[model samples]
Target: MTMNEANTYDRYQRQIILPDFGVGRQQKLMRAKVLVIGAGGLGCPVLQYLAAAGIGTIGIADDDLVSLSNLHRQVLFTVHDIGLNKAERALAVLEQLNPEIQYIAYPKRLTVENAFEIIGDYDMVVDGTDNFSSRYLINDACVLMKKPLVFGAVSRFEGQVTVFNYRDDAHDEPVNYRDLFPSPPRAGEISNCAEAGVLGVVPGILGVMMANEVIKGITGMGTLLNGRLLTYNACNNQVYELALQVNRDARVSMPADKKEFMEMDYDCLCGVGDKGFEIDYKTFSELVRAGDIAVIDVREAGEVPAFDKFDVVNIPLHQLSRELSQIQAGIVVTVCQSGQRSLVAAGELASAFGNSKKIYSLKGGVLQWPLLHKKELS
Candidate 1:
């Protein structure tokens, strides 16, 4: 055998020796290109396994930075990686794990303008993102491009896996994410991992499972999760699979063509916009410094890393209604651990005050405040 062939065999010999997965399957893996969005919990294991499996080209897309809280679940990063971009950091670590593979890091959030361009280059896509806006955006982009997408999601103790926009045979019509959830959930209706705490192992388990599905799909070796949803409960270690049916009516919610898709506002549709009242940390800082706005910490009392930089009212979301009178300022801003509860609080405030008060939710919440403004604060 040639030196290169001998090396490839030595590297992946364990998998190559499997009953059905031999050098042929390994070769297919080496030729497949996959793009993984969100280098957080799920993306970490998915990237690690896929890289070790020798996927020819892997792309990492994420705009978030490594933070203390992420270390528990995002295994790819360490304490030293804090404040560093997740995609770039993941790329660096993944390269060390398997230098034979090629890695591309897009240190930016996936949006409509860039989704198609980046996704178009990959044969299949993996949905590791946590938010509804990104989930729907990636799903729609994959549907439009007719690319297969492997999806994974984790909550408090439950995790789910599925494959979208994939067909096993020529006669079958493919099903996309929209076929399962036609529209985005109303903001705050479904809490993410940030809002509803998740056990670190939940995502780690689901991420490895997602990587398995990707390999299965690429090498055509096993039954794909297409048209099926598998849900796992880590608490009891129970697993169940549900058959997913196409929702024809859901197609109406999808963009008619690429033109309309590019113009769509997924954030607003997902309720993250809060009707244009969601302000970033910079805007929140400016408003706070102005001393004319009432900053309300919607998180419950005793939450860690308290925001004591300025005078603010401590009102948990559950008690916001009874304490509405406490906020005397005409301009109000809501804050929370991860902005989910604050978005709901802002909606409530808007409902109560109408046009009489300018109500806004601090996007990304207090957890990200110090990270985003450390330079200015220091």
Candidate 2:
């Protein structure tokens, strides 16, 4: 390491002073590589602390943009970052916090194709991703590579944390993500934060826990939750840790190859595909500009103050099933008051139409639709 590198260790003085994590363990932290998969609710705190802890290299992968709604929980971005890419905003802040460590930003959505590529470079994968598809993809990829994943997920006020697919490959037994939830919950079965609501600090607690797990795993100290699940109920201030065992039925044979890691259709894998799917407004604009896809509005009729210029059919959610076939084998845009209905309807379309057709969920529904969406249809 160069002279500038020598000073990197000095930045972690506060943490270095902690018992068992003196200069020696601190050095390990400085040399460790960590990847945080999302920059949302759980991710903000996870990345924030990891950077501050002096992790040598950190990478963040998120394709979603910051929104007013996200600002309430994803503390990393502010109002000014409303439309900026999440990974970009997180990287900007993280870099400033600790220029001592190298920070990389994967501003694209984490997909099966790029999941491992994005995570394999790192030693620990901090899962802040909300959707099951991403979770399975990340877990599957990590298991295949024998990488340790610090997983944290929050639903409403309840949160779950676990360390799966650690370095210990004794008997080649890998505790896969399926061990937690054997099957993906149907789309819209559980209310997402945007629909149901979550306390601002819920993900923060879970995220910080994940960051702690990463730190412990890197330094090889503390009891890591390798085959256990830790659940926290902030509303009740109750915490529980339960041991986990590999499921014989779901003990996915250690992936046969790396291609398996990239082949999962998170759309279908996470049940999001079943509800249709989401594409960024920018991407929707691109597809519309190309003049190939049809946009559909699933919002309730008269539910919103209409100012749309997009050539979309106002097929209300209640009427979606009847008019389903009306939509061609083209990209469908689902719109709602904020976005919940559209997400639900989108999944409906995907399940029936299969993956050949494209479906996109408008962020924040029509509430945040960009002016370009109107300009294109007009």
For each of the candidates, the C-alpha root-mean-square deviation to the true structure, in angstroms, is 6.0, 8.2
Residue pairs clashing, model 1: none
Q: Which digits, one per residue and each the tens of the lDDT, describe model 1 over residues 1-378?
A: 222677777989899999999888888999899999999999999999999999999999999999999999999999999999999999999999988889999999999999989999999999999998999999999988988999999989999999998867841777778888888766765668876689999999999999999999999998888889999999999999988887999988898878989998999889765646689888877887776799899999999677776777899887888998888998999988887789878878887898999998888887777754744643
Q: What lDDT does model 2 reach?
A: 0.79
C-alpha TM-score for every candidate: 0.80, 0.73
lDDT of 1 at 262: 100
lDDT of each: 0.89, 0.79
Q: List residue ranges in candidate 2 displaced over 4 A.
A: 1-9, 168-174, 253-255, 276-339, 342-378
List ranges where model 1 is wrong by over 4 Å.
Answer: 1-4, 275-298, 303-340, 344-378
